[model samples]
Target: MSIKSTKIFNSKQGMLIEGNSLELLESDENLSDLKGKVNLIITSPPFPLNQKKKYGNEKGEEYKNWFTKLAPIFSELLADDGSLVIEIGNAWEPERPVQSLLHLECLLGMVKHPDANLRLIQEFICYNPSKLPSPAQWVTVNRLRTVDSYTHVWWIAKNDFPKADNSKVLRPYSKSMEQLLKRQSYNSGKRPSEHQISEGGFLKDNGGSIAHNFFEMEALDEKRDVRLPHSVLSFSNTNSNDYFLKTCREKGITPHPARMSGGLVNFFIQFLTDEGDLVLDPFSGSNTTGYCAEKLNRKWVSFEIKEDYIEQACIRFSDPILKSPLKKMKA
Candidate 1:
């Protein structure tokens, strides 16, 4: 199906769209129109989890064909130095077994200019208990079953490396009680050195310190009373859509199911693109990417086929917490 390009929507610190991305890119528009433009493309495409839903197909052949047709345009839209991060999970069925990552690997291989197409920089695992079903064979064999813990997040870069600096987004470190006890050993008469003072001042004063990447960060900010989460997201079926609902209730707004936590999106924005760079989420779902991009001071465009999701996305973006960062950027 061909898509027609629509005018870019303009609004004050909120979600905007210009129609389906597939049709927009496939038009007679010049490729140069987007050349050296987009900084990052981060999206969690609807997993072909064989769920008999309107979003994906159950047949592997049909699934592969869909990705085959869609992957190339993404390559073309990517900036020479930009990165593409796609989150995919395994496809499972009792009767037939197939790995979705392998299909994605093959699809990516088929993109035009595989050499220039981008290297797989990293694979982030999105561990979810909800994605796993009770094991039929394992429960019978060992009286135990293991649930699937991780989904693949392929980080692809058109150039040799990502254009953004990642150290800025480093996970906070934790101080154990054992280490905390050692602080008393320091000389009481001695004043901290200038470098040590700045680095450890908060530590010296505050009773607790930041934890390492091993432990997840607090997903929500209680003081700010916002729903923004941390990079290492904790997925819960109950909390999946509750955050949006709460935010809406507080601000007199609505919710979107495809809406993801801002923490995950913020991590990608901080790690993948510099401020003011453009970010695109082709299969926008709830438009979480656009909301995150706005929060991180980046320009964003998203494409969602469903009008309901589009409206929800718009409402979510218009929330004060999401728009506050954008205002700071403009100032």
Candidate 2:
């Protein structure tokens, strides 16, 4: 199963490998230490789009079979309490505005696959308010559907209690929460649904409030203590000034066409893994997961099939915040 691949580059905290993830994960000698030790495998694999893209993807029923076969291999790389998080975009039926259930079917396939002992932990919505109206024909020309602004992020794990801490990814307290903390009082009682709220429960100010899944674009300059995060993650992928994109433009290199937002990657890496824990991204397009994991002090390994993308992704490691310089190594 040993396949020829390049180790394009490495930062002190991460390494970017160019190869087929399936073969590498199962048999790469360099990755022997990672077996059963990965804390998180966070990736946004190529979607099952109706049309093929340069990055490579399978369409329709074939995609589900392709993904299900890979689930067991992914599970084998996790520690008992390790997690797998996937961000997959929605797809539509060919030539129609109707939605496709392929994403859900793929998820179910992974979970039900005989060799994988994985379970669904939770589902989060990664909302991009600034996203342009998609499915151009249906949303714009045909005027059939509204803008599709979010992707489904599924959190699955080998164990029910995966390594996760909500406090690590908390958001800033809301205005009402700040007011409540200032007042040091509020209504607390049983509701018609019979769930009782204690006066002290809401009064105790524990930094910020728990986060929800529904997130909207908020002012980035606003600073506050971390609060609990919601299931809805709000981040836009339109930042041209990002280090990866900026460097790519300056170097006359075309960046990976599909890139995940760093904010989304940062949230899960911090929430799912601790400092020095290992994270892996089997489909590390532009190495966003590796960058986020490195910034968070976690060791990471990224697998990309394209060498050019790996080379371009190394720009992320050039930031001064990284502990060491990037090393370029031949395969």
lDDT of 1 by residue, 1-331 (tens): 1224443444443335546667766773542466557788888776665446454344566666666566567777788888887766566554433333645644365344443465677656544444334244443445455654455667777667667665656543344433645564432333555333333334353333332222122332345322222443433323635545665667654454334445566767787788888888877766778877776778876777766666566565556665442221121
Candidate 1 overall lDDT versus native: 0.57
Candidate 2 CA-lDDT value: 0.80
For model 1, the superposed segments whose C-alpha errors exceed 4 Å read 1-8, 13-15, 28-32, 56-58, 97-116, 130-145, 176-243, 247-259, 324-331
Q: What local lDDT does model 2 show for residue 173?
A: 81
Highest lDDT model number = 2
Cα lDDT of all candidates, in order?
Answer: 0.57, 0.80
Clash counts for all predictions: 7, 11
Per-residue CA lDDT of candidate 2, range 76-139, in tens? 8899999999989998898888999999999999998899999999998866667778888898
- Scored against the true structure, residue 107 in model 1 reaches a CA lDDT of 38
